[model samples]
Target: MSKVKLFSYWRSSCSYRVRIALNLKAIPHEYVTINLVKDGGEQKKDHFLKINPFGFIPSLEVNGDNNQKSIIFESLAIIDYLENINPEPSLYPKDLIDRANAIAITESINSGIQPLQNLFVLAEIENLGGNKDQWAKQLITKKFKSLENIMTKTAGKYCIGDTITIADVFLVPQVYNAYRYGVDMSQYPTIERVNKLLEEHEAFKAAHPSVQPDAPKQ
Candidate 1:
């Protein structure tokens, strides 16, 4: 079996999600840092563009036994691929309703919120003379409120039940982003609680942005 290669930025939330999944599944992979902030974004380079036409971070390169290599882009899609290939530490519930619920929660954060405040979007906002911090704060706060309400019914030690799921993978990164932009976490008790609990997990700790190989020195 050839090694898996993960292209990621240290502080990117999407990248963080994939790291958590990889760690949880105990899949060993090479970590390649694509500094999104350096040199007008290294992700836009030709080589990276070939891997992912969209030039996004967290493009996963999977090498097969036959030596063939394939790349997967998009955080959720890459995570789903990992889950499919590795079923042991299952990240989804067996029941149909529960599985769908987990996906719903994951999408709410991955699609509904994360995109709006991504680096590119924030950069665009700043280029247009908008206050990027204020923009992120408002958007994250609004989405977190909705997330808090949904989590009230869905959580149990972790989001969607006792065991961790893809929802938890999706949640922690967004919660980190919320706090980074100064969005008060106190308003979302369930999210805060779940995040606090999940933070103690080894996989979560291993995947934290601060500890990544490419994380900037403080």
Candidate 2:
């Protein structure tokens, strides 16, 4: 069995996605918390940058059977790796078109919505005297509106169908962020419904930010 270590921040949507994937695949891993805000963000520090040059959370370090070490960054790439290694209870659809639709949903959130409102981007907005909350709310609301339309057509019980796909993995965290940013989820009933069902799922519950080791005590 490969030894896996995950360097993650509790509240990062990217990290959250990977956590759900790991739990869903029942992959054993050591969780190392990287406080993104403490001491000016641990992810930007030299030691962590060595693991992931991009200074991103959810860096996966894998020591293979032959004792070769490999590091993977980026939530989508890490999840893809997990899916490749553990094929059962797959996080993607079996049908070709369904799979494509699932991937499309993942990309929509990964590239289209997430990047615009990440910590660094929001901090930069504040640096320029912009209201970070308002910026995030507007962007999330707009993208979520589009996602709701897509979900209306594709969803059955989860994001892409009754089976939970990579789309659900990506969707849950973004919806959490939407709630945090006050996006008024009622406008996106399909999204809200899917999110509600996912939140009750064991894998999703285990991966939720509030339950993470690094989350603030309440």
Candidate 3:
């Protein structure tokens, strides 16, 4: 296999999802850790910028037919790319409608909720004299409840169904962040259950921040 390298920071939910997908697909890859906080972050380094100009973590590369191919940037894109290649475990439902619904929920969190609550966004809110704590609560609760409503219709044992899918990939990490910031999960049982189940899975266990290649020395 050609070299498949992942540039990521362990704590990043986006990075976590890509790592979980890679493991679940049984793909071997070299993980290059990016310290998002150290030395002004490896992501900002000139050498890394050539790989991912956006200065974001979790940019995946693999040798392609022509050259080194950049597969995905954001966490959501990375999971989608995995579904495209290793359809076996079937992270996305194969049927058209089911697939669309599956993708919709995944996108729901990836785009609808996550973007508004990331560190950068939260920090920006704080800088603007916005009530950072309340802003977090407001955005997170609204989205969490919205996702719970959506999950009521779409979820099985996992996010999309009894089977694990790309939805789980988004759900697990986002919930982790939510919890870190004290987002009350008891109000959303389905989401709570899904996260509980994913935690027991080996792929997610292995891909956790502490075990990541570039996790801080502390």
Candidate 4:
């Protein structure tokens, strides 16, 4: 087995997704907390930037056989690598059409919703005299409406079918962000219903932001 280390922040949605994937795969790893907000964002510092030029949270360092080291950035890429290495208890569906649907849901949240309300983007909005909170809430609500529609058709016990897949992996964190921005989840019944079930699952519960080592004590 490879030695894995995850560079993460407690409340980062992207980081949260990777954590769930690791837990679901039962991959042993070291968690290194990089406080995203402290000291003007630790992820932006030179040392961390050296690890990931994008200065993003959820960087995965894998030390495989022969001591060769590789770093992976971006939540989806990290999850895909983990899925590839640990194919059992797969995070993707076997059916090609089902897999495509799962990927569609994942990318919808990854590229469509997440980036719009990211910290940097919200900060930029604030600097432009825009209401960041309102902006985030509106954007999340709009996207979630679409997600609800998609999930309504594809969902079973999980995002694609009875089995958990990449769709559920992406859904959980984005829904977390939706709650953070005060987006009313009731309107998206399908999303809210599936997220409720995922939240209770052991792997998802273990990877929640509030339970992370770096989470602020309440």
With a 3 Å backbone cut-off (N, CA, C), the pairs that clash in candidate 4 are: none
> Model 3: how far is 131 from its true place, Å?
4.0
TM-score for each of the candidates: 0.96, 0.96, 0.91, 0.96
How many clashes would you count in candidate 4? Answer: 0
Candidate 4 lDDT (Cα, 0 to 1): 0.92
Candidate 1 pairs with clashing backbones: none
Which stretch of 10 consecutive residues in model 3 shows the poorest summed lDDT?
A: 63-72
- The lDDT for every candidate, in the order shown, is 0.92, 0.92, 0.82, 0.92
Per-residue lDDT of model 2, residues 39-121, tens digit only: 99998999888887888788999876589888898898899889888887899888999999999999999999999999989
> 124-182, model 4: which lDDT tens digit per residue?
99999999999999999998888889989999988998999988998999999999999
- Model 2 scores worst on lDDT over the 10 consecutive residues at 62-71
lDDT of 3 by residue, 92-203 (tens): 7777877787788888888888788877887899899897667776787889888899899988888877888888877888888788778889999989998999999999
- lDDT score of residue 166 within candidate 2: 96
